[model samples]
Target chain A: MEPKRSKEASGGSGRPRGRVFAFPPSPQRGVALYLQVADQLRGRIDSGELAPGDQLPPEVELADGFGVSRHTVRQALRHLRDRGYLASRQGKGSTVRDRKRGLQVNPVIGSINDLVQFASETVLKPVSVVEEPAGAEVAELLDLEPERSRVVRINGLRCERDGAVFGYTKVYVPVELAKGLRAETIHSVPIYAQVERNSGIEVAGVEQRISAGGADEELVEHLGLEPHEPVLKISRLYYATGGAPVEFAESFHPPSAFEYVIHLRKGF
Target chain B: MEPKRSKEASGGSGRPRGRVFAFPPSPQRGVALYLQVADQLRGRIDSGELAPGDQLPPEVELADGFGVSRHTVRQALRHLRDRGYLASRQGKGSTVRDRKRGLQVNPVIGSINDLVQFASETVLKPVSVVEEPAGAEVAELLDLEPERSRVVRINGLRCERDGAVFGYTKVYVPVELAKGLRAETIHSVPIYAQVERNSGIEVAGVEQRISAGGADEELVEHLGLEPHEPVLKISRLYYATGGAPVEFAESFHPPSAFEYVIHLRKGF
Candidate 1:
C-alpha cells in the first residue's frame, strides 16, 4: 500500500493541522507497528520537519493521523520520551524537547604513559589520607592477605580547573610503596610518576575493569549528582615487575565525566 | 586518645546491648572518622563477628562504643546502607543484610575469536529485524552519511541457556552486509562468525567503548531490573579491511550481566 499522508500534509483539507505529515505503513518493515511510528516521528524530528518546541498533536489526533490506535500512538510517544526526545504531562500533552548535550570525556589509553597524560588533564586532590588494614575488597584487588596487609589509602576527587568535582577516586597503595603518594601531590603530575619518583617502583603492567552502577550517597555528595544517576566505575590495578600489584585505584565517574574508548585488532 | 568503651561492652552495665563491639580510634589513620567507623563496622561484618540478620546496637550505644557522636554513628550506618551492607528504617533500627551474590560475566577479549567465545556463552535472540534509514546515532556509529545510508537493525536480548534475559542488544548492519544476520540465527554462534561465514566479509578491526547508563523503562521490562538500577553499556564497531565500519552493535547490560576485564602491557 502507498504511504499514507495526513490531511494537513496533502493540503487537500482545511487549514493545515499543525505539522501532521506522511508516515510509513504500519508493519511495512520487520519492526513492530508502534516502533515504525516512533521511527517515523524520530526521522521527522531529525529532518527538522517537526522542530523543537513544537507541541505534538493530541494522542487522539496522532492516532488518526498515523492511521493507528491511540494505544499505538501512546507507545510511540513514550518511546520517544524515554529516549530523551519528547516530554509530556497528564493534561498538558506532549512537546518536542530541546536536547541538551552533556559532558563526555574519552580517555583512550593503551599504556602507562597514556594514562599519565589523562591524569594530567585533571587533578586528583587528596581529600583524606589514612593507613588502614586492608578490607576484603581492597585486599582482593591488590592481591594481599586481608589480615596481614596494610595499605595507605588516598581518597580524592578528580577536579576540573575551576575546582568542580566530577569523579570520586580512591587509590590503595601497599604501605611499602606508599610513600611517594604520601607527600603533597603536584596537582598536575600523574600518580605513577609521583610513585616512581618517590619510591623507585616502576609499573610494568595494568589490569583494568570497567563497569557501571548507581551513585550512592557518598558519591552524590562528592560529585554533586542527583540521586540514582548512572556512574561509570573503573577499577585499575598497577603491577610492578614480577607481577605484584603495587597500587589499586578505582574511580567513580558520573555521566558527565566518563567515556572510555579503545581499539582491538584482529591480529597482532 | 584511647578508644572509648561502651558501658555494656565494658561489662560494667546492667544488660548486654544487642552487639556493641569496640571500634578503632577515630581518625587514627588518614581516613575520615565516619569512614573509619564505616570501615571498622564493615570489617566486623566481614569477619562474621556480626552476622547477617543481626540487628546493630542502638545509635547511642554505638556512639559510646566508637567514642564518636550519635551523628557520626548515623553517618556510618547510612554509608553502610548505601553500599548494600545494611538495611534500616526510622524506628526499625538497622540490620546486617544478607548480601546476595549476583551473576557476573567477565569477557576478556583480545581478538575476534575471544569475542566469538564470549558470544558462544550466551545467545542473542532477535526480537525485531527492521530495514530502515539509519538514525543519527546509528549513522555516527557506522560513520555513514545519515540521509543516504540504510541499515538493517537487529534488536535482541542476550539470554542464558535456560532462556533468562540478562542484556538488551541492538546491532545495526549496513544493508549490504546484513544478509548473514537475517538468516535463522543459530543462537550458539557469534554474530561475527555468522556474518563472515555467510557474507565472506571478515572483521579486520574492532572499536569498543564501555560506559554506564540508567535502565530506562524499556530496558527494565527487557532485563527484569528494578527501577533506577545501574547498567553497564558496551558499544562495538566492526570494520572490514581498510577500516570502513561493517557493523555497529551496542548492548545494555545490567550489573547482574556485565563485567569486562582487559589487560594492558607496557610493551607489545
Candidate 2:
C-alpha cells in the first residue's frame, strides 16, 4: 500500500523527497532485497506519485534510506529499466520513462477475420506456406470431420496505409477452397478477396477473439521490432453466406503502432 | 539474415552456442557490456533456440565464449535472472525458465460493452468509477454534440471460468444511459445489461479492434504478474439494437491466459 505513497508524495515535492524510505521495510523473505525495493518503487510510479522523467534518489542515498547496499539498489534500478519504466544514464541518475504512452487496452469479441476486410488499404508480405492437419480448435471452427481438414497455412505480414506492420497474419484456408490459388497471389491482394474470387464463396458472418502476446523472432524480423516486444494477436473466422466456416486466420501487431477504434451509437 | 542463421544453426544442434564476437573487445558501452550480451541471449531465447530449461555453459566458459570478463557474464546472468527468464545458483550454472508455456497474444477490439450480453457467464470486479467529459474518440463513438457529452468511466477486472483474470476492462457509458445504475452493480452483472434493464435499450451490433502491450504495475498486480509482463489490449464499441453507440470500453489481459478463436468459411 505504501509503495505507491512515496511516488505520490514525490510528485508534489519534485525533488526526491526525504521520505523515500517512509514505508516500513518488511522482513526480507528470501526474495532479493532490491526486488522488494523495485516493487515499492513501481507501485509509486503506477499511482502517479512519481511522474515520468522524475529522477530517483541517488543510489547511495537510496541504499542508506532503505538500509540496503548500493548493489541492491542497482539491482532494483536495473529491473525497472528492463521493464521500460526507468532509464539510466552515467552522469544523471535513473529517471522514470513515459510508461503510459504505450498502454493499450481493448475488449475481445470472437475473432479477427470479421474485421480484416474493413481496412481501406491492406498489403500482405508472404513468409511461408505449408499444409497441416487442423488443430482441434481449427477443426471445430471449420466444421470439418476430425482429422479430415487439410489447410494451406499461409504466413505473411500485413501493413496499413503508413506501411507499418499492423499485423503478422497467418491465414488457413481449407485446401479444397484454395484449389487453384498459388501462394504468390497472396502478396498482391487481400487473401480473403482472393479466396472469394477463386472459390466463388461469399464471406458472410464471422467470429473473432482478441488477446495480447510477445513478438516471436519471425514476427520481430518481419515487423521490424525487437524480440519480445508486446504485440496484438488477432484470430479470425470467416463464414460463407450460408454460415459455413471458410477460413481461419491469426494476426499480430506491435502495441505502440496502432489502436483499434469502433463507433457505436445509442439505440432508439 | 545472419542472425536467423545463427539462431537456426544453434537451435538445430542442441548444444549451447556462444556469440560470434569480433576480435579485440571494444570499449565497454557505459551501460555495461554484459547487458548488451544479455540482450542478444534474450533474443535467442525468444526465438526458441535457447529453450526453457536449457543450460548455459559455465559463467567462465560463457565469458570466454563471448570474449568478455567473467564478471561481465555474471552481470548478464544476473539481468536474465531478474527477468524470470533464467535461474542461477552459486555452484550451478544458469538455466532458462519455461516462459513459452504461458505466453499469450492480445487482439484488437476496444470495449467490453459489446460483450455485455454474451451468453458466456460474466464476472466483474469494480475498482473505481469517475465522471469525465468525452474525449475525441469517445465522443465520436457516442455521436455526442461536442460539449454536451458526459460519460461515466467505470474501471474493473473481468474473469471467465476458473478464476483466470482474463481481462481488466474499463467501460465508458454516456451519463444519460448510466443513470440509476450504481457503481456497485458493476461487480455483479454486466453494466450494459443493467443499463438496458433500467433504461429499456437493447444492444445489437458491436465493433472492436485488438492490440498488444506490456503489463504495467497496476496490471501486474491485478493479474498477479511481474512488471512488464506481455498482455493483450482490446478496444471496443457497443451498439444498440438500432446500431447506435451506447458505450465504449477497453480491456487488458495476460496473453498466456486466454486464446481468441475465430472460424471463417467461404461465402457463396
Candidate 3:
C-alpha cells in the first residue's frame, strides 16, 4: 500500500503530496521556531518520510510552509548539519544524511589474551603523562585516599594505521608505582604489558564497568565528533595478585569508530 | 586558584562574573536560539559557574540577560532537563542537577558460570512477544535474509526486587528454532536456557557487541528515562553448538541502573 499523506500535506485532496511537501509546518507556538521545524524534519527522517539522499524542500518553500523566515529554515538546517543529520552543498539543496554512516572497527576482546592481541593490533599514541591528585571516584576505584593520594595520569589515543583515533584512554597509576615509567615508552606498548615489565608485578585480574555517554568537549576535540554524539565509556580497575587495585582506566569510544566484541560461553 | 571567567562574561572588568550573569545570549544567528542558550548553560555548568542544587536565575532574569523571550529560556531549560542536567520542581524554580546522578551496578561476568549466576540474580519481566520480519541489522547479525526471514521477538525488562528497571533486552529467535518458547516460560527462565531446553541444542557461544546511544522514544517510554538520556547498547549473537547463529539479542541499559562488568585474568 502506498504511504498515506497527512491531510494538511494533501490539502484535503486524496492525491499524493508532492516530494517537496509533507507536514504543513505550524506557527512558532511556544517552541523555538527553528526547533519546531527541526523536530518535524527529524521526525520525518526518522519515520522514513524523508529518506537518505532525499532533498529537503527549498528554504523559501519551507519558510512559506512553516510561516517563518528563510533565516529560521537556515537555522534549522544548520542545527541538523551540526548533529550529523543533513548535508548541504553549494548549489544543491540540503539532503538527508545516512545517520548511521561511519567507519566500522570490530575488535574482539573477551579474554586477557584477546585484549593483548587487540592492543597489539592498534597503535598507541601517547598524548600526555602527568602526576595529579586522584578525584573521589578515581581514588575509590584505585583504592587510594582521595585528597592525599597522587596518581600518574597517562592519556593516550588508540588508533589504527590511518591515524584516525577510535578511542582515548586515561590510565591512572598510583604515584608510587609509576616511578620509572615514561610517556615515550607507553607509545610502543600497552599499559598492562608496560606495568608488568617495569614493576615485575603480574596483573592477576581486572574489573571493568561499561556504560554510555554523549561526547563532551574533550571527546569532541580528540575524536573529531559532532556535538552530542554518543560514545561508549569503559572504566576498568586492574587489581594485583592480592586484590589490590593498581590501575584505574577510563576509555571513551565513538559509536561508529569502534565495536567491542565479547564472546560468552555456557558452562556445565 | 580561582577560575578565570571568559572575557565576555567578565565584561572587561577583569573580575569573574557572578552566577546570576554569565554568557550573554546572542540572537538566533544561524543557530537555534535554544541550542545556543543550552550550550552556554551547559558550559557554565561544566565550568562550575553554576554548581549542583543551584537554582537558575528566574526566567525573567534569564530572558533579560539572554535577550531572548521566556519561552526560549523554557525551551533551553527543557533541553537541559531532557539531557539529565536540570531538575524543575513544582513550586520552586529549575535547579542544576548533579550530572553524575544515579545508582551504579557493577556485576562481574567472567566465566559461563558467572553469566548464569548473574541471570539468576535478576528477575526478568517479559513485556511483549511477537513474530516479525527481520530487519537489515538483525538479519546481518543473525545470518538470515533481510525482509524475508521471520523471527520471534521478545521484549523484556530486567528489574531488581524493588521493581526498578535497570535494562531492557530484545531477544530475537529465528522462526525455525523458536518452536515452543512462550512469553510465560520466558518470564521465569533466561532465553539461552530456554532455547537449549526447547530445541535440544546447546548454545556453544555468544558474540556480543557493545556500544552507546541516546535513549530514543521507545527506550524513553519503556525505561522511564528522560529524553536523550544515554544508554548502553549491547548486541549478542548466540551460536548453536554447530556454530550457526540462532538467536540475536539487543539490550539497552540506563547508565545509572546498570553496569556491565567483565573480569579478565592473565594467562601463562
- Highest-TM-score candidate: 3
Worst 10 residues of 2 chain A by lDDT: A102-111
DockQ of 2: 0.17
Q: What is candidate 2's lDDT per residue for B1-268, written digit by digit as tens?
A: 2424232321221122445532233323344466666876787788888898788878777777776667777877776654446767667778887643211122221223224344146577778798888887678667675556899888888866455567788899999999978876677677777877777888754555556778887787777877777887766666775446787888787767665443322121
Instruction: For residues A1-268, write the lDDT of model 1, one tens digit per residue.
Output: 5534454322222222323544643235334557667887888788888888788888988877776667767877866764446778778888886533210112466445567667877888777888999998888667688968899888888887778777899888888777656446546676766776778877876767777888888888878888878999888988776556778889998866667776665531
lDDT of 2 by residue, A1-268 (tens): 2424243321211222235563354434555567777887887897788888688888988877766667767878877765557766666677776553221211222123324444424677788888888777778878876567788889887775446566788888888888877676677666777888889988764556666777788887788888777877667777776778888888776767654433222211
Query: Which candidate wins on lDDT?
Result: 3
For model 1 the local lDDT of residue A32 reads 58
Per-model DockQ against the true two-chain complex: 0.25, 0.17, 0.25
Over B6-74, each residue of candidate 1 has an lDDT whose tens digit, in order, gives: 543222212223335555332343355677678888888977998987889888888887766687678
Whole-model lDDT, candidate 2?
A: 0.65
Badly placed stretches (over 4 Å) of model 3 are A1-107, B1-109
Q: Clashing residue pairs, candidate 3?
A: none
lDDT of 1 at A14: 23
* Residue A140 C-alpha lDDT in model 1: 62
Candidate 2 chain B weakest ten by summed lDDT: B101-110
Predicted complex 2: CAPRI docking category:
incorrect
